[model samples]
Target: MALSHASLSLISMIFLAGSIVMLFFVILSGVTSTSPLSQTYFLRADTHGISGARAISQWTYFRICGDGNTDCSASYADPPVGYAWDGNPNNAPAELAGGHGGDTTSSSYFFMWRFGWVFYLIGLFFEVLTFGSGFLALCSRLGSAVSGLLSLISLVFLTVGVSLMTATFVKMRNAFVADGRDASVGTYAFGFSWGAWTALLISTILFCIGRHSNKADVPSSGRRWGRRSRSTRSHRSYEGRRVKEEYP
Candidate 1:
């Protein structure tokens, strides 16, 4: 019932690959789009029918008659266009308006968002280490003890990083609520990015199981073969002793 090192290595590699893919989704959903950390609302406009505000952490944008009469749905983009961010609340605000440190109202949310990325980057480093360890395990190039140790360390880093990202999700949700936006409705709710987190968590668990597999003799065949060899040696020794006794 022992798991083979080869199998463990294979599984580890799969999990590591999945982790990397999930990290990409996390980045795309978080950095590229405005889900899990952004919200939009309607504001009264003097010149237009309504001004729109989309706030993600400290980055806020106002749009003059962008989507007031329409469905109020807008696309997310880098240096998001078609939005005013003058902070007027009644009119569109200036474009690209906000400090990197986040505004005073939602500074903590921004901090958490940035902090989560830091954790992810650190975790990526550990994941790379795990990749090397898994490769060594597969090739029998390293001792079992060393490979297992490295895997354990990598798992710890990955877990911490993913956990921090979970915290970011929570903070973002809270920020949505603080702005009087209903997080339960529409895109304000958790989306594909959240699903990525779930996938990441499952991958972590799989990696742990795979790492444990490496600690054993593997496939049970090796153990059986060893026992068979020992038994054969014992039988030969017995026969030799009997022949000597009879001859004497």
Candidate 2:
């Protein structure tokens, strides 16, 4: 039982390590400024030129970035103008003959389209708690029950966060159509965010197993047997005394 418990603890830690790695990867993707899910564009108006890109997720929104040297340049949107562009109305630039079909000023939208950021951060907090508890259990500094409880809580938060993010993406896709653009699966891909969710889910399950195994390791059966044996002996002794007194 002890060995089994130890093995479970070890596996739990491994799952946690993997989750941490995925989370770090998501961070790296963001820091590199190369969105795991977004699009870039090149605009030209007469002699003027501009470069632009946008990336978005349920939990967060990277603002549309544009760089151009001329004010009268034309903004040639990507083929079909998939998700991520603003849907608000705007005047066409001199470069494009028709009206412009670009994203609204990113500043007009909140940092995160909805409360995706809030849920994501909250989920992160629970993940940290799970990590801490798992480490403590692995080191024998904390009991398995505590670690398991924390992991369960973390799982709930992660689930909610992941769901919210997915909804955000769907919302953005719908907005694309609303804004007179074509939205396709190709345009709205589930990138590193999905990977992160997968990792967290596995970690949560492992922690649950570790918690159950820990409870099994305690010597409860032996204690229960001992108590029963003692009670039987006491009852026998009492009967023997009563018989001796009656016979004598």
Candidate 3:
């Protein structure tokens, strides 16, 4: 069975709301000391030798936190590509030491996270625009088309952002493990990032479907109106002829 325009709009709004919530949580991770949220992070690793570094560190979007999210560092717009440790480069892992052909703190790593952060903000902005326009989708075909276009744009930005984030952390985790350090990825951050993307994708698709359905209904409605007009005109002509004959 085909869903009406209103029904599709409602479902799309629900998915868009879910996407917004997931993105908010991901962005706010490590910004506070609250349970569950505070625990959220991208990568966790044992960094034992570097000075000014915790024995175990969890990297979040805005800052690095010590084990169990205690003693978090000051937040930044674009977090340092390195672990923000201060000490002899030799004590740090080869992947992060940066003095002798290391990757961490390099221009490549720095730009990756920086651009990824920017993309996330951009994606969220467009998603909000899509949601606001979605209300019109319930009644107007143009509204559905506009909302779908905005959602597609949001999805593109989010895809790039999440891909960069995943690549950055996955490589960092692998580097730590290669150095015989325990490393793990954060489940909440990973799940939320992808989950939000999935929801936005679905919302975009539903908006398109609703738009097309509205278009399909127009011609049939016009045909029905045409047929009713023709029958009414013919009935009026017959009544006129009968009156003329009786009067003559």
Candidate 4:
């Protein structure tokens, strides 16, 4: 049972590691949620030079990226403008087009890949929860199968976390690469730093621990036998009682 649990945790952590790596590159596709690209980033509309923090998801003509020029509309938009702001008229607010695609200047709209940070944080939280619950339980008498189930769940979520963070990192890196140092602060919010790697390592460790514990929990697997033994004892007692009653 313990070995099975350990196996679950180990596999989960391993999966998390792979996911985080994949996410790093995947996030680089979209734009970061930092200050507008100053007429940079995303597939801008062709009408004006205004920067649209719209869907950076598309890599096509107007959907690819243009700096508000005749060739590509000089904005990160298409025939229709998709702002990371309140570009929608019906829902447009007095402070629409304030950037980051929300009604208020400070507000944020999470279109396609607008706010990668939010998802990254959410992923982090779920990872932490899964890690916390099963970390210690790995070596305990917990059923290995249960641990394996949890590890599998954790691995799935770990992929989400890595993908989200990677997406955010990619956007940030692209913004920097496109605009240069003058446009953005040297470091991206979703950075490729020691801390990020450390997080991955920790998640991986927890996963292994969970899997390793699974292999040792053999007793848990024998519950059926234990139940049968108890039932037999009960039957014996009932028979003895019947015999006593007959003698009396």
TM-score winner among the candidates?
Answer: 3
lDDT of 3 by residue, 115-200 (tens): 88889889999999999999999888889999999999999999999999998889888988888889999999989999999999
TM-score winner, 1 or 4: 1
Task: Show the lowest summed lDDT stretch of 10 residues, model 3.
Answer: 95-104
TM-score for all predictions? 0.50, 0.55, 0.85, 0.34
Ranking of models by TM-score: 3, 2, 1, 4
The TM-score of predicted model 4 comes to 0.34
Pairs of residues at least 3 apart in sequence or in different chains that clash in candidate 2 = 45-74, 86-103, 86-104, 92-100
Number of colliding residue pairs in each model: 6, 4, 0, 52
On residues 1-248, what C-alpha lDDT tens digit does candidate 1 reach at each position? Answer: 76665665566567566666655543433222343323322222222321345332222122122222222333332222223332323422222223432221234434554455455566666656666666666655343345555555655655565555456445444544555543322132233334434544454454455545544545577989999999999999999999999999
Q: List, residue by residue over 103-132, the lDDT tens digit for candidate 4.
A: 323232224233334344444454455445
Which sections of candidate 2 miss by over 4 Å? Answer: 1-7, 33-114, 139-145, 174-191, 205-219
For every candidate in turn, the CA RMSD to the true structure comes to 8.2, 8.7, 4.1, 12.6
lDDT of 4: 0.40
Q: Mark the 10 consecutive residues where model 4 has the least summed lDDT.
A: 181-190
Measured on C-alpha atoms, candidate 3 has an lDDT of 0.85
Worst 10 residues of 1 by lDDT: 57-66
Output the lDDT of residue 65, model 2: 25
